[model samples]
Target: MDLDVAQVRAFVRTAEELHFGRAAATLGISQQALSKRIARLESLLRTPLFLRDGRGVSLTGAGQRFLRPARRTLEAADAAVASVTREERPLRVDVWGHLYAPTRTLAQVAGRAGTWVLGHGRDLPSVTDALLDGGVDVAFGRVHPPLRAGLTHRLVRLEPVDAVLGADHPLASEPSLRPDQLSSGVLWAPGPLDRLDFLHRFADRFGVRARTASVNLGLAHFLAGIAEDPRRFALLPADVPLPEVPGLRSVPLVDPTPLYAWSLLWRTGDGHPGLDRLTMACAAEARRSRWLEYDPARDWLPEPPPGSTAQVYPGSTPGGTRADAPAP
Candidate 1:
């Protein structure tokens, strides 16, 4: 059956809102018009997309199944339009933190092409979503649980993390930190729980409680936190070039130091001309730089402690038993 982009858009908007009046208002259409559009979509598919009742509207099984693919189609449509209309806009590469490796690589790629832009995600998950949604052509992030399918990433680097401490703090002068030494301070890692879960789980294994606070992935927040309280510490990537903050220091974590495995995430089937060129450039750059190949066998941090609060991912070593780590 032939598909209608208008009808598909109406269905997606309604599916998101789950309320006909709200969706219609957001779509700038009358309720009757919106209803007709959805009806046309249902007719094309020969299925009831939603179940309507006094309680409200809810997606039927068919609607639930169609929602994801429909969203992808809409995102693609938007991306295509933007690419054509916005000639002045440079292609964007999204990164979460202060990592320059991806930028450096993409800059080399852009030199061969045209101008490119650098975008930043609040955390790993957001950057991953942006890549999938076509908001950004490429991203630098950690390969962890619940990564979206149909996406591919290259292991660019394994970043040794540091314990950020206030300059006057007693342990600030220490050459490196151990989990035991950091236990006294409340370890404040930035970003949402999901993005930092690996660090949390690893720290839990060593009896250090790592707490997370949602903040913009920028240097301003990191410096402000340490300035407010000397005891506040954060786990940050060591390899990224960070501007020296007067009152803060980044010290390597020892005694089973945690590593942030960085990767270049991009949609596998996306065939943007720039992305294709960027991918080739990135591969050549990675080959020359000898980017670190993450080995699941030995690269994993110690397993989560028994009965840890967070969920342990499947195909992982729980409580120190060896298991094949998930492939990146």
Candidate 2:
């Protein structure tokens, strides 16, 4: 009997997420539709794949055995489609954390890279789904932990962060401020603190109280809001071009500078030629600009993936390791 590709895809995604709602959302289908597909696949195989209960869902013994083959089947189907459909299309690249302007880093290397298209993802989960479904070929953002299987990422840059506040603020005159010095002030965030992973982790690690704004108009508006209140402060990449908003001041954060980590993400088995070109450009630019330098004693970064600092490209050294990472 022949297996249905769509049904197998549904099963694979459901196994990965372990939640019908999330799996359906990722697949851009209704939960009922996903359930129907799974049911049909189970009927075809004459075995149960998932044990569902009020608490959650778990893979059955049959599911555990079918998962690997299911993933291979999906990948084979994708490869078959890509062999003809992908030849003339440019690599589709997407990014998240637009507030931080992740494109700035990409812009530096794009001129030297291959032809591609750029898009924006709502958040990490949205971009992750796009990557898994082959909608996007590459993505750039802060790579948080517990990433699903069949995906990989490379640490490309460790950008220094700056603290923005009003010129009239008490600590504004200081040449540089430590993380603890700003603890007494409010940490202004573009959105809810829980949704902004980097900012949330920063505040937690530094013991700073975070407050969210009702809306984010743009960088100028956001900074102006911070400038309006003496107790309000925000964090941004040092390289982000600040609009000349009156009373706006950006001061370097010192005594363990907070570093924003940027990483490139893609599917594990994708063989797009542009992927290599983009990664090579990242490695070259990273080496030229010392983009990956990280000194644990003098810099602060959210926990990174295991062995992420060794190099930016395979068999190539870009020097992000602590031993060779000099202070920024």
lDDT of 1: 0.65
Evaluated at residue 319, the lDDT of candidate 1 is 26
- Can you give the lDDT of residue 289 in candidate 2? 84
Off by over 4 Å in 1: 5-67, 71-109, 112-139, 146-149, 175-183, 191-195, 210-218, 239-245, 253-257, 267-276, 293-328
lDDT of 2 by residue, 1-328 (tens): 9999999999999998999999999999999999999999999999999999888999999998888777767767876887888654577899988878999999999987789999955588989877876667889888877687878787778899999989888899999999889888888988887778888888888888746664777788788887667899999999998888998888999888998888888888777778888888888887788887665667777774345343333313644321112111
> Which one is best on lDDT?
2
Winning candidate number (TM-score): 2
Each prediction's RMSD over C-alphas, in Å, is 9.1, 7.4
How well is each residue in 249-278 modelled by candidate 1, as lDDT tens digits?
A: 889876556656555677776655565555
Extract clashing residue pairs from model 2.
none
Candidate 1 lDDT score at position 67:
82
Clashes of 1: 0
